[model samples]
Target: MEAFEVIQPGPLTTIQDLGRYGYQQYGVPPSGALDDYAFRTSNLLVGNEEGAASLEITLFGCQLRVLQDTTVAVTGADLAAALNGSPIPGWETVPVRRGDVLSFPRLKSGCRAYLSVVGGINVPMVMGSRATYTKAGIGGLEGRALRKGDILRAAAARPVTGRARVPTAHLPAYDDQVELRVILGPQDDCFTEDGIHTFLQSDYTISIQADRMGYRLEGPRIPHRAKADIISDGIPLGAVQVPGDGRPIVLLADRQTTGGYTKIATVISVDIPDLAQTKPGDRVRFRQVSGDEAVTALREYERKIQTVKNSSA
Candidate 1:
């Protein structure tokens, strides 16, 4: 059904779900929401599945006009969202009417926000996913960021719904600095002991060159034992690769399928959402954890998500 009409397509608004999976071997990078936690929560609030496509708004919010009555939820960053000139809250569901204007006026926190409707933003799914990979011009409304005058259609959803909320304590916290947990391995031996210590102890700032692909950090160069190059190998999400210059690049959802740089550590999956919310100039520190600890954290994270999913919406 007809859903939203774009009045203003902010800076980098795009459609994303969980991501395009199992196609990495084909060199297709998984392009999805940077903040998957927010993305999933937004969907749950609107009675949609976790992977349902939604609008991922970057930095500032966009202006979208509702074309039908629908329950909508906005999650992640607080953008000072307003519905028809009245303030509306985030992390909860709100009923929007036909011709109602949903607009974002200011960015108060985080790097991105997700807007999910009763069904979901219905773009033809490519590669088993509705994610937009702009670099290759593949999924999502023409495979690019949302454009003005774009008419977004929504998938059909079932009846029987009310309001849902993610408790304030459950919401993600944002600050100037965030500590990301990592499991050093796979290529950690390539770096000297001092390099590992620097990576785990020192503070690094997100460089101006941050994007969906990766984040280049600027800080003390991590001392490599000899070289930083490696045989071309598959690069996983959140892989922290140290290049010849010693700067580390934290690969993200849109990272290349294969790379030659030596990866020093990998940010844990549960913590990647925190990393995704970081903006340029944010300070980051890494903490090393054991494989078992990382697995336990992931299990706990999934449990929390399931708990929220079971709530009455």
Candidate 2:
């Protein structure tokens, strides 16, 4: 059934699910929601499966005309969303009716937002997923950012909704400065000890070059022991690649399958959501942690997510 009609497509709104996975061997990138926490939370709020297809709105927001009464939940960056001129609540299920308009007129904090419907977006699955990897022109609605006049549809018409709201204590903060935890790498040996020290000590500002592929950091040069090249190994999510330029780029979901740059460290998976919500010009500092600590932190993060899911029910 039809959901909303796009009046304005905002800056970079795209349809996405968890991501198209298990195809990296063929050089395919995992393009999906940057803030998985918010993405999953929005789906849960609307009573949809956590991995169900949804919309990822970036920076500026969009305008959608409701074609039917449906339940939706917006999470992630606070974009000052509204329903027919009334302020829309974040992290909670909101029932919208036909002819009503949903819009995000202002960016209050953070960089991205997730909008999930009860039955999920009715986009065809590609590579077992409905994520929009615009660069590949695969998945989503024709595999691109949303355009005006586009009519969004849902898998089923489900307007009846549960009162699902994320507790304030569990809500992630959207701050300009965030400290990301990292595990020193598979290639930390390539850098001088002082280089690793600089990485952990320095505050890097996110440059305009930031995107789903990776965040290019502009800060102190991380000195290498010798050269900064490797034999083009698989690039994991959150891989901190430092090229000869000495600057670091934190690779993310849409990162290339393989790269030759030496990866000094990897950001723990759970911290990806926090990194995803940051805007350009934000300050990022890294803290080194042991593999055991990383694992423990991940388990704790999952526990928090399960709590949210339980409350959603």
Candidate 3:
């Protein structure tokens, strides 16, 4: 049955999940929620499977009406959400009866928030995912942002038989100044020592020009050693490339499959969620780590997710 109708289109709302994997050969970039940890946690809280399609709302003002009874949970940014005029707590699943109204006031902290339902959004899957890649016009409801008066359908989910809650300890804290972990990259040697030091030592502010493709940081311009352009090679997510301008750009989910720009480092997957929540003018610093250390941190984060799932069970 249908879930809700968009009464007001937020700043940027799109359907997303873990993302489409193993499709880069077809020139498809894996498009998914920017804050994956929060997205997955929100889905789990509502008893939805991992990688379920959830609405990713960016810095506020979204309104929707529930057309059917549903269980939903919000995670990531504290958007000051309310259901039927009553404030709803973030990181907890709440039941929404038919005809209930859901509204988001504004972003209290963090840039994006995820709203996950029990069964997930019922949208046609493209390349095995319901993620909305607006640039390519694929996935989601007509592959676009939710507009006013747009009705959204949701898969039929079993009634809530048990309470599944995300433990308070597992919830990430929102901070205006975020420290992101990175691993020195494929083109680390191409940058001067001073440039590399600047990236680690100086604080950069997130620019207002951020989007799904990449997040631009406004800081000391980092210059490259060689002036010649390099051949475009496969670029990974979190690649922090310093183009001709010297400003670092951290490529996100919908980034191009390959690029020729010199990359200083890559943000570890575990910390990308923190990067996603950073807004314009938010201060951020990067710390370099060894590959082994990065892997260990990722494993630890996965263990925490598993612990939460077991506790809920």
Candidate 4:
């Protein structure tokens, strides 16, 4: 089978599509790309379907040797990637030949990166998705991160000549501090007005406890009007759940199926990628927006993605 040989699987690298859906009722977490913009862009650049399987590299990156001629595109974080020892620009489609080695020396910005080939990663679909949910040891390449010598097959049988490039205006800029828009939530009334003020006004530093499951923020305590306990409720993506200790945790793709803590707000869908790119020690600020505003923002985001897809096509 035509595939790329894993030479050095960096800190964390896994195959992921959009996500595993419709199985959440069975307690399955939606395991997908942290940065939706980058994931979709990478696929578009390589002429693959927007939800095609791609590699999500975290903090660091890996090295891979092409076993066949193929077209590839790297998106999300700038990992200072190189092809055959020469620096190769990301966010643009590039061709690789058999035996060509790709490496990422260091991270320049952002927390994760996505690598996509013309044909998506040809991993077997589990629950209708090739996404990897590492916690349960399901999906992806062997239901885990890739290891040295592992082979990743591509869906495309032959190399493609697609030459897509993401516009600079569409690219995201990463920083140590990010502002995430939120919608005051189902449990907002549980928090005191002062607590809501503190949450909206204060800067919460991303704690080391941050992971794919959630981002624990360390900052001023958010006082509750009563108690911080809630009947275990369905945890939504980007749910800002606050525990008894008063710290807020913004849930992400791998968040638990249910959470008992009171959720004060939900990070807007459009800003989830910005939060996902944040690393430990980074600062986060929340801004409250009306539900209508959030819906408009999401629609705008969808239009932006559609524009890129149209251009690529």
Error of 4 at 119 (Å): 1.0
TM-score of every model?
0.98, 0.98, 0.97, 0.97
Residue-level lDDT of model 2, residues 141-180, one tens digit each, is 9988999999999988556546889999889998999999
The digit string of per-residue lDDT tens for model 4 on 1-313 reads 5669999999889999899999989999988998899999899887888999999988775999999888899988888989999999888888998999999879899889899987899989899889999989889998998999999998854456657788777888989899999999979999999999999999999999888889999999999999899888899999999999999999999889887899999998899999888899999999999999999998988888887787773
User: 207 in model 1: Cα distance from truth in Å?
Assistant: 1.0
- On a 0 to 100 scale, what is the lDDT of residue 276 in model 2? 96
- Best of the candidates, lDDT: 2
Candidates ranked by lDDT: 2, 1, 4, 3
For candidate 1, write residues 1-313 as lDDT tens digits: 9999999999989999999998998999998998888999889888898889999998875999999888999998888899998989999999988999999888898888899987789999899999999999989999999999999999887643667888766778877799999999779999999999989989999999999999999998998899888899999899999999999999999899999999999999999989988899999999999999999999988877776787737
Q: Identify the runs in model 1 with alpha carbons over 4 angstroms from their true place.
A: none
Q: In model 3, where do residues sit more than 4 Å from their true spots?
A: none
Q: 112-147 in candidate 3: lDDT tens per residue?
A: 999988789989989999999999898888989889
What's the lDDT for candidate 2?
0.91
What TM-score does model 4 achieve against the real structure?
0.97
Off by over 4 Å in 4: none
